[model samples]
Target: MTAEREAEFDFTHPFYQTGLAIGVPREDSAGILRSLGALLSWQFLSLVAGLGLLLLAVGSLLWLVERRRNAEQFGGSPAQGIGASFWWAAVTMTTVGYGDKAPVTLAGRLIALVWMFAGLIMVASFTAAITSALTVSNLQRQINGPRDLPGLRVATVADTASAQYLTEQRIEQARYPDLPTAMRAVADGAADAVVYDQPLLQYRNRELGERRLDILRNTFAEQLYAFALPAGSELRGPLAQEVLRVTESAEWQSLMDAYLGHR
Candidate 1:
């Protein structure tokens, strides 16, 4: 079925017709988790810590150079001098020279120039790292939407709505027999990304473990999953009724929570 027809049927289908059946709740939960994961990731945290340490080291060096030679501006107990050095380093690194604290010695000014350039590079690198990790929607700033599909090596399962959509869009794609293989193609660098059902992709991501892959928050072409039965089957109505009953039950809600927790 076309995505539009499938979406219409999903809203009316017994499996999704209950009053509590909100649409695409899993996507919202996944988004929250992804954001949390990015912020708490060890790699990003380590980079921040390293930058802080580097700044402190530079501050310490500055205090040593100015401790005896330029005693007026940096004179006092070692601790006070180090504190002043730190403040200078911070202000200079951020390119916000308040001019309140100036290094008088030639050695101090030379060190300041080096630290300034190093700080500039470090800041740019850190910003790039954050942008790469958190901006999951645009993979490398390439795949913003379905319209940006051309020239990308997309992967999707055969006989799925995603495959059909790719065909209609005339986007280059590698069709796999199942979701696992399609996802693997992306992980293995054979494809730029995998396009599939959002909930199923989220489940797969959980199974694969943390942050190995990213899913785009923007979903397109919604569709419903249904059980296929023989034409004019006598059991269809009874099965559908059972599905409706189970879906609305507390037990079923618990099961859903277990699999896909609330955001």
Candidate 2:
């Protein structure tokens, strides 16, 4: 139903509400530069920094265990041995296994063996940490709700209440011919979001079947679907009473679920 205004036909008590919602692509549709930029965010950088520190710590421990007795591989001045150990730690963690260095002492060999497994575990953890950081950064690029629409490429159906709402908020938008096109615009990276009726967006997205889009849970500028009648129609009062009764009934809920889905 069209969003109601008192100047038009008389509207009965609202039987259903379809609020305004934001729709965005399921995956990050940002450009390569944007993706690289997201990868450089503080969280990801911190993880890399932590990994560097962990490698240095492991290398220093190995250097201490080998410097005295097994100096041939882990020998030389303190700085040189630490540098060699650091190189070993880097290559071993990455599984490159250069095979140039070997620890000969019992304690040194034990430290090296322990570090091999520890490096594997740390590398796995570091990879997971980076992936999580990137995913989080990608999600942050997607809008959380209406508050994020400002300064973003907002798409909406032309000549709609949603467009009007955006205008009222002084938000510039790219108006499309219809909802599907607006949704497509977001998927195609032409727009950041599609603002439309909640239930309508839900139904349309389900039709896509690819889960290419995700609708924000938050709804704003709610619109009510009501029965419209001729102005001052004699049936308005009685019809409103019936609508309220039916809409409030359990059977009505079951019917809604049967047709519209279980929300």
True-structure lDDT of candidate 2: 0.81
Each candidate: RMSD: 10.2, 9.6
Clashes within 3 Å, all models in order: 0, 0
Error of 2 at 6 (Å): 1.3
Q: Please give the range of 10 consecutive residues that has the lowest summed lDDT in model 1.
A: 17-26
Q: Looking at candidate 1, what is the lDDT of residue 47?
A: 84
lDDT of 1: 0.68
Of the candidates shown, which would achieve the greatest lDDT relative to the real structure?
2
What TM-score goes with each of the models?
0.45, 0.56
* Leading candidate by TM-score: 2
Candidate 1's residue-wise lDDT over 1-263, tens digit each? 33555444432233531111111112333555656667677987988798788778898899898888867767699888888888888888888889877776898889988988987887788789888778853342255567666777788889867777789888877899987777766666567677777667755666654333566667677555455555566777877788778887889977765775432
Writing each residue's lDDT as its tens digit, candidate 2 over 1-263 gives 56356667888898898789988877544656456766787877887888888888888988998888878888899889999989988998888989998777787678778888987898898878767766765665568888887887899999888999999988879999988888888777678788988878877776666645788888999778888888899999999999989988889978876665544
